[model samples]
Target: MKRVLCLTLALLSFIPAVLRAQEPAAPQEGLNTVMQKASYIIGRQFGADIKSNLPNVDVKALLEGINEAIEGKPSQLTEEQIQATRVELQKVMIAEQMKMAEADKKKGLDFLAENAKKPNVKTTKSGLQYIVEKEGTGAMPKETDDVVCHYKGELIDGTVFDSSYERGEPARFPVNGVIQGWQEALQLMKQGAKWKLFIPSELAYGERGNPAIPPNSVLVFDIELLEVLPPAANK
Candidate 1:
């Protein structure tokens, strides 16, 4: 379910294009057209999934609630409340997708565990699974540590999205400024140490696609920790 959720979230970015093309210009009436389109997509998708997953889900009432929330007249919910509801709806979608991702991940891991001589992967509490290669020995950096590092980041498909090593420049940043995966993993490495890290989507960017990375991406990084900047030098 976790694996499926991750994958589904990643795939949702692709859905907007298909849905937009099929959906005609929304009714130019009471509700804001843009909000109506967004609400329609979200409500319809959730309604369809609930019908399939939970037999008891009242799709009609659920949709009416969404529409009423969107309408925002006689204002039962404030503007902030309406926005919060939308965010909550999105989270529900993500949660359902995550459930599916977990199931798919288990199946994938099971197959690999059965077939491979030594499958190097472990699932974490947050439903993130990873394979660690070449454990490093040295002092790991804390979230506050300023560090110099060389890394090549890639998607599961071997597409090289970003690389400091390729650019011939070690990147510099405070460890906490990066994604949660990097925050956790870099803390495990020290100066002059190199490690290969396989990061799960939840630890990386679960649903949101950053500038280079797509949604639900499992990222691989060949990371070399060059130096941990001292306080004076960091300034």
Candidate 2:
């Protein structure tokens, strides 16, 4: 196979370099000394790569395969067997991920149900909830309008995922282009208003959450509507 030939040539290239290198008279050695160092370096690099990519590797089987390969023995598994093992692993990983998503969805629903009963919390028809911290007298932004706002987003457990306040700058975006929760809430918010929003996962990132957010996560945000930009300004 091409892969086997490539690997063989790579190993063979190291031999000539090791042979050409001069050694001290007292410690005259050949390719064996160089091979020991090369083996250690390769093993260390492979170990690091495996730990980073596959934390739950089978150490015994991995070592056995490496030993057998180094001893020039034929592979114990056929190509078909290797592909089948990989497919099975993928299936198991998917099953575990789905199980976790289901658990998270149930937890989110329970938390939202309890949170809906809190004083000052107002729920919209779309299941968005908010506590008006500071109501504004200015005009509210429409779906087509662009608005500037400062916000701090967090999970139900109070883990802060993002914050415009920390950066000392407000974010600007089209009202309709944001998550369903933001689009619904922004239309109800007037400029200079500050509100604490409790968003269900369905209204937030849904099942496939963003990088910092987990699947089926309940989100909280302290949002301040700074300015509602005119349609011309957006252009």
Candidate 3:
């Protein structure tokens, strides 16, 4: 039942163009209408996405399934076949993800080992590494203190995932409310301090990463402590 539902969903994904045909695509002389241009652009994006994720696709079978679904016709494949496909696809995906995660873990371990040897970088017992960019004159924040700070988070490959400076605003949050790595760093930082942090996966999001992050990723952050406020009222 679940496999049939998954197959049904896969077909439904391609039929949205028919369901949301509010603005029609005109005759294909020159892509004149907004809907027509959108259709082509969306097709390109979807093609790229499917090419990457659904590796070694059977194009003929895929198109046949899509066409039948759009035309409201019966499925060509039997329930048993669909179930087999679902089970195999799931296994393949799990294997690929595990392989990737293992590679990332090894990469992170090597990176931390090399980074800890740098004269400027300080390593804590928890495997958090940091370089003090600028010393601060203000008092250090307690774990309960709310701090306003700007930070840029990135992967080891220099892919920026999050940044307060890019958003043109500083963020205010309790020191202990964040990930273990950030919590450790915030307590050690005083107002007006600047530091670059290398956070291991164990202290970061770890195996269960969010949409913006991947599993077993080693994260780097450039952090500036602006000001430390009293503990939040709700806290």
Candidate 4:
């Protein structure tokens, strides 16, 4: 009985290999097809982000190295080749990402610069600047205020991936507990103040973009300060 059980187990394992080998290669080709499609889609998006900044960049090589690393094939090449490739790939990715970030930063600064030339724009002491295109007299928050706010955040290209507003409730956090841009801009607002904020990548998510925002993405926020709790509110 034990011998029969062992044979059965061995055959079960071999059966799969035998079946896989005997099957037509069409299914494997199909899998490769899907993989290539997915890779191309992702690569294109990445290329767009990189291209906005890098005038002469080889996104394909960078992506191929990244893919190889992800696939655990770093040792596929000779050790020397692996080391060299890794170093070059790292430099390219970092440089490209940095370039993209700088471009986004410049875009934000450009917006500010152009707006500064217009009337009614104001600059605050904390380097928080604003051009109130439209003002809603809803209460705004004081500097020390802890507030509940709803925000819809998007890239300059209008790709919105985040919205506390869409979640059907406000995101409750301290006014001082967010990004530098939010910290600086929110303090300029009062309870119930609704503002359109253009945040430079530097002041926003910076070089390392968040999941919703790509590298070097300048963020736009439609923010509403809902409630400013009292100083002793948390206590």
| TM-score winner | 3
Residue-by-residue lDDT tens digits, candidate 2, 1-235: 2333455476567656755763533433543455456656656656766665456889999899978986999999999999999899778867777888889889889988998999899999989999999999898999999999999999988899999989989999999889999999999999999999999999999999987998998899999999998788887
> What TM-score against the true fold does each predicted structure earn?
0.48, 0.73, 0.79, 0.60
When 1 and 2 are scored with lDDT, the better candidate is 2
Q: What local lDDT does model 2 show for residue 228?
A: 96
lDDT for residue 89 in candidate 4, whole number 0-100: 68
lDDT of 4 by residue, 76-150 (tens): 579898889768867986876788677776776777677557566575554445655445555565556678888
The order of the candidates by lDDT, greatest first, is 3, 2, 4, 1
Model 1 lDDT, residue 41, Cα: 64
Candidate lDDT values, in order: 0.68, 0.85, 0.85, 0.68
Which has the higher TM-score value, candidate number 1 or candidate number 3? 3
Query: Which of candidates 2 and 4 reaches a greater lDDT?
Result: 2
Writing each residue's lDDT as its tens digit, candidate 3 over 1-235 gives 3444554466457557644763654466667665566666655655566667776778888778767976999887899999998899989888888999999999999999999989999999999999999998897889888888999999999999999999999999888889999999988988899999999999999998788888999999999999988765536
Q: What lDDT does candidate 1 reach at residue 187? A: 74
lDDT tens digits, residue span 110-151, model 1? 543443344665544554444555555666788888888898
